[model samples]
Target chain A: MLEFIDANCRLGRGPAPREGAPNTTEEILALMDRFQVRSAVVYHASAQYAEIMASNRRLKEETRGSDRFFMQWAVLPPVWDLFPDPEALLDEMKQNGVNSVRMFPAQFGHSMKRYAAGALLDTLAAHRVPVFLPFDQIGNWDALYELCETYPDVRFVLCSPGYRCLRWLVPIMDRCPNLYVETSNFLMHNGFRLFCANMGADRLVFGSGMPEASLAAAASQLLLSDISQTEKEQIAGGNILRLLSEVAL
Target chain B: MIGENVLRGEPFKGVFIFDIHAHIDATSDFELTDSSPDKVVRTLDALGIGGACVSSILSIHADCPLGNLHVKEACSKYPGRLYGYLTVSPYDPDTDLDGAFADPHFKGMKVHAAFHRTAINDPRYEPYWEYADKKRLPVLFHAWELADVRHIAELAPRYPDAKFIIGHGAMRTWEIKREVVKAVKHNGNIFADTTVSVAYDGAIEWAASQLGADRVCYGSDIPFYDCRHVVGKVATSRLSDADKEKILGENAKKILDLP
Candidate 1:
């Protein structure tokens, strides 16, 4: 059996709860056990719907004792101390064992351009900390391209690009070497095979998009893809592990 | 266990697997490297599925006539391994659904009223619905909302013979899913297809609990979503082995009247 480290998961009690999704740590652990997942990198749903910093704190508290959960913080620009300065934020993240960060530029109504978010982007790039961005929140392919191109050193993992993104995704991926794609909702037919053929297996990472998505569904894509076993291994967990290990913060 | 086979990346040994919703040929929207009949069959082979009912992307998005021809060719090439869903354009009055269904390989009909910018219960669709009713064929509709579910409920009794499979399970929202369940609960002919790209955890189990396993059939929306992905979801669901078997293939088999 292949071990899995779910790279994209949202953990928190959101306003509207769906049937069968785990919001509590115990439930999540049980689900992980059921799916044969070794661990997961999770950000709280409150980060998307409520106070960002408090949600990060809540996430830290929720996952504090478990080695199975890796914390990912939701961040914003440090304008008027809306968020901590980049250096201080990174320091706090290092202290809390938060290795990766997530940004919601479109949702938060902030520009991802250099003028608005340059300090934070520069700091993340300098530390080589992996950044997780939902593809829908990136606004458009051109915006994603600009964000990635402007900060080439910052590793951007695009989550849930969807099946229809290939027409736009390919060209951006061709230009942005720093861009990686999460495989949970990247559901195009023969997507894994085509992506590997075009971008190599290293650029793809396994993500369950759990709580709202099926863990088994995400795993089976790579498991049943017409690719070499080594390639499958890389996507199932290897690529994510490599990216996380490279996060100096 | 069925899930064990999926976890081991092996095909189901004893269970029959049939996909009720699938597509052939590439869509103009995205890149599908090998969506041809050969590739779809190879994918089914990888997952140990016996067959799939497919509609051409061309039929839904562009030229319906040319797309139906594509389906005919694919069904002919693969025989029992592939089944055709004859798609007709509501805008084009000259749709020869009767001629299209002359081929024995064409098992059902597919309608994307949502894509065609027409209501599923619109008068234009009535002729096709009547044709499907007369033949007692399974009509798969691209249903994604509460209105579509309501339309299916309204039309189901009138066309008592035609089996109505609500494509994507009316999956736009959880509330919509509830609406679909309520609307289709009393109708024997109306069924739900588990074809959404986002497969919500426990959604299938919940559906089976409410609608019964027989009312829910496995529809991968394949070539749009991988067959293995949806198959693994059903296999690993919290549903009973019998329920999983039914949803994965048994239910689809009964609906499509496949052997």
Candidate 2:
């Protein structure tokens, strides 16, 4: 059996009503076991809608003793006074052992453009921390294109981009090497093969969107793809592991 | 156990997979990784799908007659591996649709209201539905929203004999999918296909629970979507082994009347 390190996952209850039972850390661990996931990069589901600091603390508390889980913090606009400053935020993240950051600009009532996220992006870029954002909620591709072009240092991993959005993503990826796409909803037919052929497999990372999406459904795409086993291993966990390991903290 | 085997690329030691929805021929609008009949067959083989009910993209997106000819030829070439779904265009003038149905390769009908720019409950489709009911043929519709479910609700009881399979399981929103489950529950002839859905956690299991495993059929929406992902969705769903077997192939075989 192939060992998996799921790049995208959440713990705790989400803001919206979800089918099935409530999602607790235990439930997530059980699900990980069921799907043969050895480790996962996790964030609190409440972080998408709740106070970022409180949610981050909640995530820390829940995952305190677990070695199988890594934390990704939800960040807010610096103007909100949620934290001291971008530098302090990075310091706090480093102290908390957070290797990555996730931004829910739309849910948090802000734009992801340079005007709103400039300082945060600069800090993250300098720190070499990867940030996860949902492509659909980012308003438009042009904004992402501009961000990638402007910030050549920070690694941006767009999460849950639909297969239809490839036309826009392909050009952005071609133009920007720092940009990456998560594999949870990137369901184009032979998308992994074509992506690896055109852009290189290093630009793609494995993400299950587990507890909200099917782990089997998300991972099966790469497993059954016509790509080589080495490439599959990279997209499955290698690329994200490399990104996390390189985080300057 | 079968799900594990499917993930590991071992032979699926369960019911044979019958993809109820798939497309063939060249697609001009969007890129298809594999569009030819041979490629489609290879994909099915790779994913352990025993057979597929396929329609021509040309028929759905362009000319029905030309597409039907291609479909017939592909089915003829593959025989039992490929079953034809006669694509009916509301725009094109009727062209021996009944005669086309007489072909042994053609087993069902496929209609895309969104592609044809026609309403599902339009009077023109009445004759087609009538024919399907008479022949006990299944009709697959590309349903995506609540209104599509409403249209199915209106037409399904009217043509009770024809098995109406809702394509994509009305996969726009969770609320709409819930309505689809309810629609299938109330209407006996209405069925849902597990293809290219939103992959919401427990969506397949919820559908199976509400409508029973026999009402949900496996569909890959192949060439546009990956068959492995679709199969994994059903195989890993929180349903019983018997239910998973029924959804993966048994139900599709019964719906398409395949041996």
Candidate 3:
């Protein structure tokens, strides 16, 4: 039985169109241990799913002492009046061991295409890091990828990119090798087959998107997958280790 | 007994225990477990369940159309053992809808508006309200707090002909308290479920008082919440055994119009 890496996680927030009962951190970890989770990229949730920086704040508070946790990605202000200089924010994220930031434009209500490209392009240029975005919204992704190629300095980390999204993105993976895909939203059987067949397991990384996703459910997918153990290890934890270590302090 | 505490399932003395609100997702990314329908049935059978009512993973997306369809097909194979609530997002564009809700196999309907990004009174979904009324079927809607209470209030009275089950009645946070008070005041067709996993102290008691035991139902919120956990807590609450029995099974049977 191999331990898993959860690329996406949300906590400290409450309900949505549907809400789960409130769960404390200790309650969450007990569920994780049932699945044998080795690492995770934790985020925070409140009324606004990704509107606030609560995930970042919670990451510092919860995982301050534990090395088993890593702050993968966080939602931040769109380089606006709240945050004028994104470099400082990037610096702050880097200090907290967050190399990437996950963003949701549709749910967040501000299309990244509208304001994020320039600020994030500049920030990534200055900090030389990746800006993680939801996988389905293609407009932002195409815009971000165009910027990444143009800048050649910044990287784009796409989280929860579904199997269909990956298939749609096959044409550009070679062009932007700097792009990394976290397999959180994709299921074990379907996502496993798609990533193994089309994207190749090397570009594929394992992430359960825990808390919101359980380590057990995520781990079970790999356990049930027909793929080799080598591919499983890389997707489960090894790939994340390599990707984040480059940006790790 | 199952609801008496965690890790404590109701003792089986040749009597079957059925949890109507139980749900399971095999490959769901959220903290959901993968007890596939096969595994789910087996687990339940092992726990001395004659049958269990279930839902699916499509709540996170509009996939409810396919998810429910798949679940119904899966339910057909189980027939007597696994009953299902045809999951619907009020805003699901693909709801072949009539065929789905009217399907002979599905026990009833479930509405997760929060996932669908619509409020209960959103006129775009009047079609569902009309259909549910026509079928004389009860629909379970996830109501987390006061905002939902207001939303439910508007819809419940308007559909005086419809039977509505209010989920999470105990932990009315935000405006849930205000919303629920207004709802119960205006609508007599409203029933609440004691599945508010956590709101604060006395939330469950308050919800039971406000909604009335007859108006409250038992739900485990299977995938995100837990069946065993809810069973233990509610069954052991300060309520009378009659109240506990009503919440644990009787209420759901009545709301769902179970045979």
Winning candidate number (lDDT): 1
Give the alpha carbon lDDT tens digit for every residue of B1-259 in model 2: 5577645644455468888999888675556666788988987776667889999888888888889899999999999999999988676556676789778889999998888887888778887888888998899999977788889888888888999999988334677777887788788999999886437657777777777889989897887786778887678767888898899989888889896
TM-score of 1: 0.97
Each model's chain A TM-score: 0.97, 0.94, 0.78
Q: Which regions of candidate 2 deviate over 4 angstroms?
A: A80-83, B11-14, B26-29, B170-172
lDDT of 3 by residue, B37-113 (tens): 77666545543445667777664355776677667866788887777777766556557767775656576667777
Screening candidate 1 with a backbone cut-off below 3 angstroms (N, C-alpha, C), the clashing residue pairs are: none
Question: Candidate 1: which stretches are off by over 4 Å?
Answer: B92-97, B170-172
Best DockQ among the predictions, by candidate number: 1
TM-score-based ranking: 1, 2, 3
Candidate 1 C-alpha lDDT tens digits along B1-259: 6778877767777888889999998776667657888999998887788899999999998888889899999988988889989887688787777777788888898989878888887898888888889999999988887888889889999998999999988344887788788867878899998888567677778788878898888889888777778888888888999999999899888888886
Clashing pairs in 2: none
Cα displacement (Å) at residue B30, model 2:
3.9
What TM-score would each prediction reach against the true structure? 0.97, 0.94, 0.49
Residue A24, model 1, lDDT: 71
Tens digits of per-residue lDDT for model 3, A76-147? 445446643576767777666777566666676554442555666666546555556666543545765674
